[model samples]
Target: MTRTLFALNPGLDRPAIAAALRAHGRVQVRQFLHPDAAESIHEVLSRGTDWGLAWAATGKSGAHIRGPELRAMTPDARARFGLEAGQSASKGDFGFLYAQYPMVEAYVQGWNPGHPLDLLLEHLNAEPMLGFARDVSGIAEIIKADAQATLYAPGHFLTVHDDTVVEEGRRLAYVLSLARDWRPDWGGHLNFIDDDGDTIEGFIPRFNALNLFTVPMRHNVGAVPPFAPVGRFSITGWFRDK
Candidate 1:
């Protein structure tokens, strides 16, 4: 029988969460999911079979090239995607295979009616959780979501970028971490960037924690150093205004 993903945590304290969002434009909620639900998600992701490699090339012009298209890019083509002389010398400079984006929509769509991921997506887009998200983020018009599962293995990293691509309609960005025994030294921390390109604040990927920030904030996932033993897994995406 398929398991249904349901709220594990009793509820969020709306006032406190809102206060944090208002004060810092970001917030982290610990014990965000019910223990059982979180465990189920972790298990599913850990055992997941279908995942595609995703890479992003940020050109000097600041444009981006993503997904499978990155593979056949020539040196000149790579440069067009923002690879520079020194940056291109290293193999890992402009690309990485350890970084991946799991097709969540496929998982949900291909599963049986009561599949956990399907139920979880439904839970996120509906009910008390949706209402709570609106109230805390103060984005009353947020009616949809765009989310996917992500895996950051050794040497995987995401560079700085604001979640402000106008077409995405992203009002808020969120990450629900599912890594266990994650240590600061392992280096997959999510760091918020200041205007000057310095890291102003950072959050470790704690198990069952939900971290959220307003759109257009510069941020990046610190590289997972080579020695790290496990992948940093999470369900990450945006809350959109429709």
Candidate 2:
């Protein structure tokens, strides 16, 4: 039997979430998943080490390369990807690990059939959850979901950008936090920016919380400082329309 990935709180009904999204263009649902399910998914991601290093220079295609391959890029290629020429490839900023959607689904189903993450993604893209997303975002044609596991270790960060790639069909963006007992002071906040480039709000990664927002909004992941004891982990993705 496929396990239910989320057990919605009674207070977090569809209408309530829709109201919040309508008012703010974003909403966060706390305790979004059952404790056992959340724990299992968090365990798997926390112990797994097969993460690919992902990086991108401004206006360049993001590359997922191993440590050695990143070291082997030509000077021009490095510069184009926002890497400093002549500097050690591993020494620059802008780095994170991402397990892309398809690979993650395949790996989980192949190795641990009916894994929580797989089931969670399935649930999110179907039925009441999908309907809820559509209703809340007021985007009736949202028909697809894409997701990936992201890990921001010490010193890792993503720069400001509006998720406006229309070709990707993204209509809404979502993040499910699996980090436990996270601290705001340790960084790794999901921050929103205004037109003047000022930060208006930010969210700490709280375990079992799901954050969803309209796409094309400006945002960035705050850097995880070196002294932070734990890495920030989440499953993040976009809801798309055909």
Candidate 3:
């Protein structure tokens, strides 16, 4: 695979973006990455990586089943596992079904010695990317970020919740959309909710767009129905101060 930069787009208008963020408390930067980098990221996510299933049958914290081990499960065993998870979701318990590549965990634990996503993880915490995050967010206290690649495939979703990990020093949450050829009708929208649990607004999973918002805001990712043609691919994480 070609080495990717994960660099922000040189053409970005930083002042304009900063203003938008100031005004809206959230902003989406389209064509957020350099063209080649975005292309490489999308390619890697779609073809060159192993994916693991992530879900939580009860509360907010999720457990994962790695891809290879999940594949090795007997069909009935797999079905039973999924059915249990689905049943929890049906009961309105916090549940989700999606694929993820846990970037920060893999990086720190030496899970894959030279994995390509590791490069991206490091970039998120280093130099210009870190500095850019501080500048735009107007939160100079932000020191680093954690990242993970996410794929919302057909029938996958996330329930509503605010990102409130105070112990983790999370100051802002971000999602960089890499999904291409995704349709509005296909679901997979990042939606914001009000105190009443009604959706106030939503953003489509558009290619090469970045969304950033202050933490502790109510939000959820809408499910991608089975009829969708592509997975909603993205790298999501929180900028932290601690």
Candidate 4:
């Protein structure tokens, strides 16, 4: 049986997290942005490539893959990352379900400077909810971003990865972890792996927890349900620029 998740708390911050994360590079964890962020992002997603959100459940020959894909703008900003509308080649094993939503590049080019996305960006850049992106490109820098949803069930896992690309010169990824009532045993832990991926050092995900870190390292999410019966859900985002 599937278990219903509890609502996420909008405000979450461990008093010591700020100081601790700074030692590593950067870090923050809090409730995800409002449903407005999720709903509004959905509006933008409609313009992206489409596939049934449930495509993960169906086999490669599944019914969802045969469905129509939505078309969205290919922002010049996203092109730099070698991203393209409807491109699934780069997203990895999670790519199948991840492919349906168009992923945009967010380094060199720019996002819609005046949209709500920008509003959030402005607020975050100046003063994030938990930690601060205070260093220049010297130590770490942060950009702005948005991401859509995907479906992952039991046995599904988002492999650990890092955001730092030396050539890309982008460091630090700040995410607002959305979704709630995630049990430790539900097995959807966003394991923060060390450079080797052999050990889990830290994690900050729960209702209202915010996660911030340097990128291009290596990390992965723990396995999903079936080991447990709860499906995981979250709307997340990152901050980066260099």
Candidate 5:
């Protein structure tokens, strides 16, 4: 998966992604592939990440997943890296996954990577994921890249919430779905709340699909399932710091 994704695009999609998030609350960016990228990424997530005991009481969750020398892991691959499972902030029924890549800690913290991170960066820059800051929040040009993965099981839900708290130049909130060829009977949809915190803009969560939205708005994922065994898997992250 990681290898395929890396081979698909290479890096992030700045303009298109920005437009999608700005217009539709989220966007699904395509990924390129590399031979062993996916398997290696999963290995890092499963054992290399050092989740420690903090994740025991909680589930796999974090703020930064993509950074320099970083690779996003897959479900089957994460077992080797040490994956954690936990409920959403508002709802406990729906569980999510989390892990962090410290190699890019410096990049997410402050250092600028050059231009906006896109799929094109990997082969081009010394750090493919490194790029200029451009999301929302408007503060520092470069900020920490806080990202993570989320999986929602049956009867699980993430009550509406927003992702804009850190002050940075265009803070980014994104989610990439991993579940493939699934039916709607599967629960776990991200609902974007309007300004009044009522009404929904959309409920998106497609495979390899990336949704980027500015913070400050309310949103959530879930609604349990009346069907059989169908869950939601994706990676959610924000470009910011504590």
Candidate 6:
């Protein structure tokens, strides 16, 4: 694959996407990026990114375990951490366990100086991608966005919660999937749950699909089954007004 700047498809149906957002508060744009661009992006996530562990347990405010620390952990230590996180979830705590590359944080700290992921973050925050987000969501004053690369391996999950942060200025949450050939039984789907604890809708991870939804909606990334052979790869974050 050639090293190239990321580009939007230019042929997206903005009006249709906008309409769907208005009706359902969410929409999935399939083939969201140009084919070549999509392939290039998948290559970055699949082979280029150095993933880290992102997990949370009760009373733990710091969630990220950066790549270096993750690499230093023994297999037993990693499993112990996972077990603790699982235990927290079983006890009704808000917790999540997934591999993450904190894009915005990395860009700020120069973690991988001059990497494409940094450039990708810039592409998301600048035009025409920024402008496109405004047009589709009808949420003007969306000045920026923050992102993180995520890989949900077997047993990784995000528990149900509404994305509500008053200080964060988050208007909508988005996910761009790089996962392909994912099976339904693998169980890493994004599900919207109702107040009654029932799933109202769910979206499977599909290659090159962009899933966007209004914030403050109850949702969770379902836990992957142990028998699953692949990770659910995606770049996810929120569109913000700040």
Highest TM-score, which number? Answer: 6
Q: Which sections of candidate 3 miss by over 4 Å?
A: 1-3
Query: What's the CA RMSD for each of the models?
Result: 5.2, 5.2, 1.8, 10.2, 9.3, 1.2
Give the candidate order by descending TM-score.
6, 3, 1, 2, 5, 4
* TM-score of every model versus the real structure: 0.80, 0.78, 0.94, 0.52, 0.54, 0.97
- lDDT (Cα, tens digit) per residue for candidate 5, span 1-242: 32332333456556666566667655546542242543333333433433311122134443333433233555564443223333334343323333332333434554434312222223222233324334322334444454443445554455555654544533566665555555656756667767766656555556555555666657776555747375455545665434
Write down the RMSD of candidate 4 (Cα, Å).
Answer: 10.2
Model 4 scores a C-alpha lDDT of 0.44
What TM value does model 1 have? 0.80
Listed per model in order, the count of residue pairs whose N, CA or C atoms clash below 3 Å is: 4, 1, 0, 27, 58, 0
lDDT of 1 by residue, 1-242 (tens): 44435574777777998999999999999998888778888987788434445555424332223345556666676444223422542543333323344444555557345555565677778766677779899999898776677788876677667878787789989999999999999999999999887899999999999999999898888888879999899988888886
lDDT of the candidates, in the order given = 0.73, 0.71, 0.87, 0.44, 0.46, 0.90
After superposition, candidate 6 runs with Cα above 4 Å error: 1-5
lDDT leader: 6
The predicted structure with the larger lDDT, 3 or 4, is: 3
Off by over 4 Å in 1: 1-4, 59-98, 101-115
Give the worst 10-residue stretch by lDDT in candidate 1. Answer: 58-67
Model 2, range 1-242, lDDT digits (tens) per residue? 44344654445567787888889888888887777667766776787434545666433456665434555777676344334211222454333333333334544457446655566667667776677678778899999787777777766677777788878899999988988999988899899989997999888999989899898888888878879898888888888996
Clashing pairs in 6: none
- For 1-242, candidate 4 gives per-residue lDDT tens digits of 42212222345334455566657654555544455554444444344323333222211321222124222423453232223211332344322233222123221235334443334434554545313444321344445444434334464455445655565555555544544566676766666776554655546346445566666656666656567554444444455454
* lDDT for position 79 in model 4: 33
lDDT of 5: 0.46
